[model samples]
Target: MKDNGSTKYDLLIERLCETFGALYQGVTIDKNWLCERFGIAERTAYRDLARLAHVLDEVSNGRFKLTANLLPSLHMGHLAEFANFAGVAHLFPHHDGQSLRKRMNNADNIAIHGASSRENQQYGDLMNSLDKAMTDRTEVTCFYRGKSRRLQPYRLINHYGLWYLAAVEQGRLKSFELARIAQFAATQIAFEPDASIIEELDTTSGIRFGKRTDVTLHVSAHAATFVTRRPLFPAQRLLKEHEDGSITIATAISDQNTLFRWLRYWLPDIRIVAPATLSTAFMKDLQARCEPTTSEQPQDA
Candidate 1:
């Protein structure tokens, strides 16, 4: 099959230009370097650079260098659009209108504006190593909760002020909290992750990658407004609007314990609508709690 080009080609060009900046004076790269860096054949390496041929000039028989600074200028124009999408353009402190325009015009101004999280501050190095492993498709070993385990990390997630790694351990997708990681190291062993596993994890909520349950809840009219305004879960959807002015919300809950906790918070305003077994368990728990204990027995002689 002849080549119609691929995103990998564009990515390779971008990575090369970014690594050895286009502004570098008399910088050159050889096909062998690209082959080693991108894990491609000599023919594949040359093919990947086909689209970037206009900006690159051949310095020698098998060597090439970027002859134009076209990429940075093109990337800079998308800064304002990206800032707007991120909703952090306003967070950038610009004293004057001109300064704001100038700062937003430069892509360097777009950054994660936040104080260092304690978890991130502590495990910053470990997280960096894990990120590198995930990017390179390398396996990692970490001691978590007194047990050492090997993992093929797929993705890193930050949810509710905690860092979690979604990884494949012993052929199962599991999530491990960074705080519980006692020791961490990236290994030289590389692994290819299945697209299905990554897609499943991406759609899943939080660090709970265990069995998921289809949970449904009913919210009273007053509380329904709040529920609709701010969904209980990221993937929560309104299944129906009841005639009694209530709303039926459905979400796939990975952890029933977590769902029960949330139910406790919305007590008077919300009720379980489906998964009768869970509803029964919750009622039994409530009944058990409400019943008088031996300690509350009458003290009268």
Candidate 2:
């Protein structure tokens, strides 16, 4: 049978897979051998080898094998491609594959400790549907926070182990926690994705979207060392170092809750310096927490 476009493409995929498997096992292959094995022209064989030239090196006049230095990267590239093909690549955030390979190779010398949000398998179908809608640029109607919302999904973002969907609702960009979304359904309505919204999503550091408020903070000497070691806030910047080892920092926050959470974590060491209203509000909240509620009050004996 004559090879059609689909047949040719399938043949190419099969050839590439076999070639990758051979090279991964340290088996040497030659252009002539590939042509004979695949029953393809010499030019096509050359082109196939050329596609992998970056990771292959000639061992002899006609034999080529995978370059030792690129083996780990090649392995990671293969896995990434397979994951993309399986449509599950979005489950993990993008990372340097070579670095990941190196880390795995030296696993004995490394230990990672961090917290991640709990996973619910029930959301698997929702995620798949959302992925298709985002890819097709289709509108979706989902119940968020017990309210029906119409959204134009843009990107599924994973921030600090939590999953969120960055989408446009009522012409405003917002981040909806994936765990909170319910009654998900793709609408027949198709919408053109806005370039500016996509650009904002790419540029924004965290899940919080839209206009932000600039908040300046004072890091006490007690927390200055840790604060100087790394940024703990969104769009954090070092403004000045005080003579007493304290530091002044500035950060932009689109949500007050986000700032409040950080402030609560670093309490007694970090304080809002510029925005008096926010400081007052945080202080009142702290006081409220410290005070006993009616339910916690001592009852008449």
Specify the highest-TM-score model's number.
2
Distance from true position, residue 203, model 2, in Å?
Answer: 2.8
lDDT of 2 by residue, 2-78 (tens): 66988978988999998887677556688887988789898998899899898889999878988887465446656
lDDT of 1 by residue, 1-301 (tens): 5354777567766766653552243335676777887677889777756755777777789678666553344333245455665445677674333355676568685675453345468787888888899999999998987899999999887666677889999988988988898768778998987888878886886777766788788899989888997677647998999888888888888777778778788888888878899899888877787799999988988
* Candidate 1 structure lDDT: 0.75
300: Cα error in model 2, Å: 8.9
- Model 2 bad stretches (over 4 Å): 1-74, 77-99, 295-301
TM-score of 1: 0.62
lDDT of candidate model 2 versus the reference: 0.84
For model 1, give the RMSD to the true fold. Answer: 12.7
What number of backbone clashes does candidate 2 have, counting pairs of residues 3 or more apart or in separate chains? Answer: 0
**TM-scores vs. true structure, each candidate:** 0.62, 0.66
Give the alpha-carbon lDDT of every model: 0.75, 0.84
